[model samples]
Target: MNTATASNFGVAASAGGPLLGDAEFQFLRDFVYRHCGIALSEQKRQLVQGRLLRRLRALGLKEFASYCELLRKDPAGELGELASAISTNVTSFFREMHHYDLLVEQLLPRWLEEKKGGGRLRIWSAGCATGEEPYALAMVLAEALERTGSKVDARILATDLSPQALEHACAGMYALDRMGGISDERRRRWFLRGEGRYEGYACVHQRLRELVAIQPLNLLHDWPMRGPFDAIFCRNVVIYFDKPTKQRLFDRYAGLLEPGGYLFLGHSESMHGLSDAFDLVGRTVYRKRVS
Candidate 1:
């Protein structure tokens, strides 16, 4: 769900810096489908053209064909950058406050009570961009553990496709400006404000980092973990995917979730006609129906 921007990458390219042509565009369209599970339409051609320019410039290539060749040679390596070129990863700490509200107000307390005797409690941040979402989850989970004095073996699995994003997530640092969604009390509790040369940034507390395991994952590919997770947060990720892809993804989620596990979607995303494994319960919140 996350892609690496051009700023951090250097690619070599050749001559004739013309616009992205038909044959090359078609190759990209087909390639995106095969690798990324996205169906690029004619309507997106202009937008793709504009975005590809950034990739080409970042790669130091003048020709779109050169970029295509790069993809042909190393599709897995370049796929993330190309995806990022096309769609920016827009995420923030507590981006959708309501989702956190559900976790804080109901889910956390309930789960802690159930697992208090050192039982495992797992939650997955399916497309955790740059660590915000999972770290935020850690904050609440930490508080819940202390409040109830629970002995739960709790952890948050934060994963994304973009290597850059996962690296940033691993760093667990953020500019102070990005702390808008975090309240002053929580801020003081969970973040270490940077000073001197590191001024204007905040590093997540070591405790929070321990609760989150950051990892690289492309949802379209095979997953490495077998889980009966209690909840999964995959917000704002599948909007670009076609129906079949979405359907299969939802099915897979159903497979991994604990019976009656929760699935939270993005504000604009819906499961209507896409999945019947879960029942809509709250604002974009779904519960796996125990069969």
Candidate 2:
């Protein structure tokens, strides 16, 4: 779709569309679950309909059924679009502050001790939306490295299902107003303020960006990277997944982490009945067992 045409279609979609029917909702729900493991409950019917209206209009399709048909026929190309449309990308810098506090106070300290001589530190920010989580992690790790004067090599792998979000993440830009959680000293050290045309924005410094590798990944599928990571931050991600899918994904995370590596979940999530491979070490935090 050309830029001009796509913009016009988006405007038209905002005007209104036919209501999403039961069959159409069920089709999309199943397709999303099977492909991305996001279980759209019956409650989210309106949400699904609202989010996809733009896509339907963008494709010049009048009905939800037509959109579904296009999805099935062009799974590779269209599935990404569907994922972008349906997935939520709400995030901010230093969100869930306690997790970062724990990282600085306990996790990094212990991990640094474990690699006393010199070693690499790897962290995976699964479902990192719009870069904040991974960037915040980068900032924390960088500070720890500087404070402890450790020669440890630190890197973060930031992955998400949405290509659109990944693009924004790679750009590493944010509105100036979003800097509230950041302190004056840290802001001065880590981000470059925008000028003239880019006023009211800030970009992450080159050094921090270097520490992170942003990529598109669907948690439902096989991961491309091999890892015995020190930590995996999958916060607020599994809320959309069903029990079985969540269980399997948690097991996979356990397998990927080194023994005693950490898994940080969202505030609303827990591993209570999901997996026994990890033991609760703190609120919403789990530590992998050697066994």
Candidate 3:
């Protein structure tokens, strides 16, 4: 078929007629929004046609509407598969390094001082695809604490909606080429080069890996953590959510944070009309109101 309309949110509008194309796209769009609260736009039509065509052919279902019917009925675990196909999982080690730099330069000193008073340090990495960010945070924590001889208990919760992505994060392996922008010293200290069967990859060192616990979590679903978290890195994940969802999510983040705890969102994301419980600290960084 002609693969023209699919976009980032998975489903696209049908360019042609009402029979198969329109029905299939509508089915997918509705299903995704119902499950994840993501809004599908018309610009994604070509993308939907392109990405899901192979599946349609493989199932020997000639008409796209057939797929729609199956999804509408919520057929046997297929919805999860569709979500996996549509969710964007792009990530890397040390992405947008300034955040990490901020952590090291500003946050760590304060964290260390807090730890001296027996404060428990907890960091939540929401939308932590394949575990890179949490592990990186762990490395920073370990290095800083060790240098100061501060005995502080710290843990990172690395969560994502994709179980497959969580599995990759738990495995702690990544393409060596993806390490290009990471500093050589950081790379050498935190990652180990794979050998033999996995010769082309690099894996996070055990010390850092042990600090992060990867779990499957859908942001749109009810959260399971009991927390007054010290910091939360919810970067680059809310751009797809609708206004109401974003507002609700920010409120939830506020509820879980400790007094004066920090919240870090994506570079493009803001709390403009979302929540007033936080004070903007910097670009995409917010400090929870403490009184």
**Highest-lDDT candidate:** 2
Where does candidate 2 have its weakest 10-residue lDDT segment?
6-15
Q: List the residue pairs that clash in candidate 2.
A: none
Error of 3 at 149 (Å): 2.1
Question: For residues 1-291, what per-residue lDDT tens digits would candidate 2 score against the true structure?
Answer: 675874433322235685577677888888999998988887787678788988888899999889889878987688777888988778888888999999999889988877867777999999998899999999989888888888887899999888788888999999989878888998999999999988999999998998999998888888998898999999999988889999999999999999889999999998999999999998898999987
Query: In candidate 1, what are the lDDT values of residues 119-150, reduced to their tens digit?
Result: 78999999897889999999999998888888
Local error of candidate 1 at residue 2 (angstroms): 38
lDDT of all the models against the reference?
0.87, 0.88, 0.79
Q: Candidate 1: deviation at residue 108, Å?
A: 1.3
Off by over 4 Å in 1: 1-17
Sorting all predicted structures by TM-score, with the top scorer first, yields 2, 1, 3
lDDT of 3: 0.79
Instruction: Give the Å error, residue 174, model 1.
Output: 1.3
What are the root-mean-square deviations of the candidates from the true structure over C-alphas?
Answer: 6.4, 6.1, 4.4
Q: What alpha-carbon RMSD in Å does predicted model 3 have with respect to the real structure?
A: 4.4
Candidate 1 positional error at 35, Å: 1.6
Q: Which candidate has the highest TM-score of all?
A: 2
